[model samples]
Target: MASYFSRRTIDFLLYEVFDATALTRYPHFEAHDRETFAMSLDSVTHIADTLMYPYYREVDRHAPELRQGRVSVHPKVRDMLRALGEAGLIGANFSFEHGGQQLPELVNACLGYILTAANNSMLYTGLTSGAANLINAFGTPDLQSTYVAKLLAGQWQGTMALTEPQAGSSLSDITSTAEPQPDGTYRIMGQKVFISAGDHDAVDNVVHLLLARIAGAPKGTRGISLFVVPKYRLEPSGELTDNDVTSTGIYHKLGQRGTPAMHLVLGERGDCHGWLVGEPHRGLSYMFQMMNEARIAVGITGAGIASAAYYASLAYAKERPQSRRLNEKNQLDAPQTPIINHPDVRRMLLFQKAVVEGSLSLLLESARLADLAHVAEGEAKENYRLLLELLTPVAKTFPTEQGVRSVSEGLQVLGGYGYTEDFPLEQMYRDIRITPIYEGTTGIQAQDLLGRKVPMGGGKALQLLLAEMTQTAQQARTHEALVPYADKLEAEIERLRTVTGALLPYAQRGDTERFLMDATLYMELFGLVVVAWQWLKQGEVAQQVLSTRPPEGDELAFYESKVHTMKYFFHYEVPKTLALATRLTDPEVLTIASEKQVLM
Candidate 1:
């Protein structure tokens, strides 16, 4: 089988670009070192290669079926979850007190990339880890003891049950009701849709980190409260009984079929019980912790599937010879050349490579900032947190939006063979389609970026991010070979400032709709500049390596490829900012509907 990902590239980003080991200097991560991090990665990679990659096709072919009520998934899913749970890969980023390895998000994010690249259909443990971590962070001691261990061990499946039939993305309109009971446990009555891994026979139980509203609370977001609603209620008699959470329906999706997307019903019989997490009316804030983490996780999923697609396409292009070179086409005696030799094919492959690695670099940088936000002190901690918030939407949006395009391009690389199931490219193409819509839709994330994140804290976060990009450009300027790209990145930084400066006034004028009108376009523009910054960071590191102790063979090729791809991104992708900025600053309004104009 062809390789789906490159560990050499992962190491280059983690050690050389991010300096992940430096995180160990902080007391929280002091218990860990490069050796332990390597062990964790190696163990996860073993599980992925043996259990995940080999079944990538088989699992998708044999999607889960919902019968009567039970969700019957491919049997391999159970083994994959078990192995991951046993290896502690699920909660590897959690604290040691919670039975975790306390690894940095930097390394944890890398493991997520490897697993998803191998087989995203077997995506089960991530939900468990996210749900369990929320419980440990906000749930009471009893709640933690009851749910955290089983979830971390992968003995129970965990899911976020937020979307309702009525509310959709408008959480403020959610109607899921929780009534206080004499027994101290509230009764839950609601239906949740698109609940991934919500109900599966792969584990002993299904735990939902569900959202509901209490009686007589404040309206809108302030009224929301989180609950731990389980498929089976643990009775004092030491046995599991039906908790009335039912798998009302199962969705047949375009791809990632190995994991079931469920529609769940709670309290059909009115016996459903839910325990509150954290405080009443504070559920949304607590859930944001998990939601934000899942956003980055979604980006990793995009990057992973794209990486797999790129490799699949790369393998085919190298081996499949089709036509003679354009110059030699008239020479009938000439042999057909491999498609990789074609300029168009090379362009497509280079675009894929640039997106995959650039997305990885940005995501890894976000992960490092998260680590510092968690462990650093005072102003440094606040700065890291703000910087993380600023980049979070971009980190989530770029890999996914660009990843969708890259995978489609990968399919194009194989001609007609790519459209058929005989190749994995078609499935990868399907699987990555949901990422932009996952965690948050591209529009939702874009609104969050411009409407909220940019103007947040008087634009401190934006200022910090600009500072970071400027530093990267300055470093790139030091190496004569990288000066041109450094200028390109610096130019983008200024363009970003000008564009953001242009847009912020609408918000200041109190025109919320006008301010966020082309927010999605703004997101696209923002993604290009930030990714160019990531590329320059990579270029600076590779330039330093090539200048000093560059090794021979693959290592040398790897570093040179980094610099080359960085140049490709600066040349081809960064120029997109000009078009986006032009549209963003234009005074004419087209999208907003006016009541005076009523024709469809």
Candidate 2:
């Protein structure tokens, strides 16, 4: 059997299911058509499969070598990245004049899924470059022209620096400072820890978008400002010049060793030139522009990893022979069947399939919201923005947490072979473990959901999201087969409402940490219900289409499969929301109050 992403599934989602073709009706996407979109995706998939996927095992084996304060990735990996950059994939969504295809976020995300799925580390060089380009949009023209081309061309790479040893999650505690220089630029002096791709030698230069406090600025997050700090400065004519930024060392990782994580010292030589992006004291606002975008990317990364692990395990299970049923009625003896034939193995594979694919749907839906919000006009546009904001936390958290589960189950399916480096499952497991820890921990995302996101616009965001879910439920009610599922979801919505009412006041009363201690569980609860609703909506649409005009051949099978998967998620997975709701209000959870005494 061929191991490739299902192109038929992509077409169904792109053309039939989401009616993504309707995007052409919008002004922002007016210049693009389905053919161009399809071509771009196909090119990216080929590049990812051919160039990126092959390196996965080797990179892990020969992890970047750190020598004398400099880290060196495999030369071949660098060459492959250069080729990918030359293919215009590094800046897939940038405007045309910058040597990009000006693709919509939807198309760009679809393209990203392929590369990320093929090899996540290989995509980091481009991912950070694209992020820096977004910051460039708000930067000066000189800054834009100087940095954008190098980044987009993959001649240079980009990184976002915000973390410090003491200020891992507390931005207000960040002590890095930027002092205004007489020459209009600021001199940034700070040590950033755990900076991803902070100092990869693959590119000509590395541009860092750093967050630092200005001298004499107010205390806390409000005093912070964002800076475009390149590792090497640009000359008067737009060429490289030496800057004070240098990496001190690289952090040895548990997995994804192909991508270097470095600890960097900025302005060690007494002058590191940096251009301030946006307004001073407004860094968080601007950084969120990148952070929110990266959140969605993280979700995609999680989904991609899970997808890879799931398929790999599926192939392994179908071929690797194992012990037969306990009560077999074989007369002489039946040859041991493939593990996939066993009920337990099947259960594991199904769990991975559901979580991985469910996570994919959630991540892609968030990307679609990004597209709709950017292109649509009037009320639809605002509604999309509201929906996007409401789900961004879920987009980041659910997939990552579930991704870990999927990978673990994948490894378990391989049993003992999974524990050795000889197999890829262990590496996948290690690589994905960090997803929930970094890029805003799962706890942080949950707090954001309960504290900031849900209550934004006086709770209008949550209201809009609930309304959309309600509309889907009402629509699904028309189908007799879906009514029960819809009714269960409706009941979950009511539970979510009751829990939200209890938690909100506790958060407001300055027991925010206690409120958020349970926030992560609540986040999963909300996500399960919300994702079930999405699946239900998709199922309803598939049902209606199948009833009125049955799909032919594989198309019919695909639609039917979607319907069954949706049912699986609803009936088996969504009911867990009830347990979560109970856990949210459980008094026993507060036993953590004594955890400090235990530590003492």
Candidate 3:
């Protein structure tokens, strides 16, 4: 069987670096310990290996097609969804009352990492889980009772239908109209585009957590309302009927072709029904509840695909012998050495390792904070919430933007074969390219990080983050080998602070255009520093293991590799922040809108 993921590295992050078992001390997660976590992981691994991974190529080879106003997907999608639902993994993080196993988000994040690494094209359940959770949180009792159970059971597919033909990212300009009826439901009429899992034959029905503007409502985002629109509506008599949701077209994409991205038309015949979620004119707020979850999910998907690529490249390097070592070029009769022995190949592998592992560590750390934000109270809860809000964009942006580059590097390790269909790198490279564009593009995420998150609450979140990074650096000081890397992280934090100080003045002066002119570069700088902190944290744990309970053979190599990769990140990746900071703090304005000149 193909090893798409690394269990040892997962264990190192969960048990050693992040100390996930410690989360069980909280009342909400008290039922979970290491054993239950392992049980959930093992269950997903088995299903992923047996059902999903084997069909990775088959699913992509046959993309979904739209015919006769219906969409058809691969046959394996149904079987995969059923297996996941039966495993109780669709709602892994929900409470017992909501028909979930009450698993920690940390563990759930790991579950997603495993599944996506196996076969990302079969991504169906995570969307359902996110949509269902929104219903459970803000919908009426009738809405929850009507939708959550079947959705979790994989009997139905759930999607977030927010993007429309007129409004892509600008939710303020959406023209979708929702007229009220005496029956308390609204008549929805609009066209939505690029809706994933939007319409497919893999499930009995599909539900959309849609957003629309009610008649005579306020303008912009505040006027929007959330609605539950279904492909097949249920009547009071328990019969199903078509809801006037038509599949106008299906998008043929570059990758992740297994799930259908549909162009949907509502009220084509003027007979669409949508039940309101939460209060009217609060749709964007309600949808953000799911959008945030989707963002983190996107980050995990990026890391997962990059991880699979890394493993593929590592295995190929170990087995494929090509050239002799630099020092052995004179030995004409000697056999060629494995590619892994070549210095250039090893450098590429280390870069891949540094990106894949570092991205996962940062994602899991964000997940841990999410779990804390869920259960803690008062000041602790508020602090965790702030920290999560601060890291969400970074967690979303770095893994994806860097994952794309990392997967490309992985492809380079395979030489000519990597570009062909014989290996998975070609497909993986295409698959990971969409992650930075998913949820929100890197530019959008960057604006959020610098314009909103950094300055919010008088900058308490950034202060909290810097203090935490400082604590990690102090802990690493106990080990002599980690001190240099720890010191580098400390310097990076100061650089981040300096850059923020320089940019905040424009924001403070209400120059919105200038304030966000270079926000994307600031985001890149911030991501490097934040990931450096994660590496330092991992290095500290690895150093402790070596000092206290050192082992031989593969075990020693594992811990040593952790420390080595930490140095690799500091030496190779962290220095890029210098150029980014210089650009951010520079007294230059090149991209701002201007009326003085026009050039073709």
Candidate 4:
């Protein structure tokens, strides 16, 4: 199958939109250059295509099997993960002091898209390893020395244990207890569910970053504490010891089946030991450190899924010969043309193209912000942080939502064959479903964006975002094709600010439910406006390229296609978001009293 990620798009986004090469000016990333990053990404892309993707269908057909309290992965998949670790691609974002290459996070994000597209299930083991490495970064020195190297090297795996039976998205409602023991370790007693890669055969042990309550620490969210609970005890010589933690059962899930959905029992025998990551009763704060990273990770997963489906459909469309074009069908036996010749098929492909590529642009931009947040100095760092926070929810939600839609459309492109396992679309649909639900659900992310993230840092982040959009609008004034689109974008931004300001008093009163409900609409509006900005940026890049005659015929068509797609985005997506902004302005509630039982 043809790769959906356009090298041209990558070039345009990195150099033209983001000036990615200039990141080398920062002392933190001076060790690398654009050529090195490109080479690394090329290597990852090869591994993804040759090894990871080859087993995607096989692993799906043969998921993890649990017996005797142990989850077993296919040996081939396990070996592949080990090979990825051996190649040192697992810790692409960590610092060199931690045995990583110290590549920029943007570069890693680009490389991650390849891995995810290849086989998302197998990628979890590596993803968790990176997450653990991050946790160790912000954690104590003891924690880093003990687990950081192993996680980065992929000798051990890690999982985030947040959800409990009673504590769905409401972490404040959690009741898990962590009692401090005399040996400086806490005895953790809790049941964590829906924990991905929680227990698997590939790694020798699993380290769970669990959230639980310390005794008499208050109630609700304030009392929570983050614990580093390893599946086994570590010896002084840096080897595994029996810790008595066990996987009671694993869930038979709908997608991403190659990885296990674990139900874990921590210290069931009153022996599970946990070391605190930070201060007591400060667990939620620390866990959020991981959550923010996971948010971007989730967005990348969604984009990767969409890219895979788009590539599959695009390949199918170019190769599958169907009925002749309407104008040429009069000759009783006119030769059949590729499905791309059909206007409706072209529409579907174009829609998929705009959505997947647009989502890719947004995701990579978020990653660029991540890198900027780290290496960028002074105002540049602060500005990038604002951009990162402002787009986090959109980055996470839009791709998942659009990915699901694109996979469905891809299935439609395949007709009857799409419904069966004979084609990859059905599995793609199944796999993409979990992205929105995992890391955080769309509703949860929406609430985070509007109710929390928007107001965070006194809305400096949001203002910074508005300033960038305004600057873009200023730049677009001279371009006839882009001016109207930029104007519409500015208008929507104003509308959002006005509606959000109007709701501030209610928001301040802790009437958070209504605020969050309206915030959902705000999130959708934000995604539409933000992606439109990306599309407009792409239009600017393509416009310049098209101004000069391209040396190659295909190169000119590719650039023109990008310009045409960006126009499609402005006309189709931006207008609809204006309605959502208007809806957010209304001070209506969706409480039980507002609707009849029949409607409910």
lDDT values of the candidates?
0.93, 0.80, 0.93, 0.80
Clashes of each: 0, 0, 0, 0
> Which sections of candidate 4 miss by over 4 Å?
1-4, 237-239, 328-331, 501-505, 508-510, 549-551, 586-600
Q: Which stretches of candidate 3 lie over 4 Å from their true place?
A: 596-599
- For model 1 the local lDDT of residue 394 reads 92
Q: Global lDDT for candidate 4? A: 0.80
TM-score of each: 0.99, 0.95, 0.99, 0.94
Cα displacement (angstroms), candidate 1, residue 453, comes to: 0.4
Clashing pairs in 1: none
Model 2 Cα lDDT, one tens digit per residue, 428-483: 99888888976799988988898888878888888888887888889899988889
Q: Residue 61's C-alpha lDDT in candidate 2?
A: 77
lDDT of 3 at 357: 92
TM-score for candidate 4, residues paired by index: 0.94
Measured on C-alpha atoms, candidate 1 has an lDDT of 0.93
List, residue by residue over 1-600, the lDDT tens digit for candidate 1. Answer: 559999999999999999999999999999999999999989999999998999999999998898889999988888988999899889999999999999999999999999999999988888899999999999999999998999998899989999988888899988889999998899999899999998998999999999999999899999999999999989989799999998978899998999999999899999999999999999999999889989999999999999999999999999999989888889888889999999999999999999999999999999999999999889999999999999999999999999999999999999999999999999999999999998889999999999999999999999999998999888888899998898888888889899999989999999999999999999999999999999999989999999999779988999899999988998888888999999999999888989866767
Better of 1 and 2 by lDDT: 1
Lowest lDDT 10-residue stretch of candidate 2: 1-10
lDDT of 2 at 469: 80
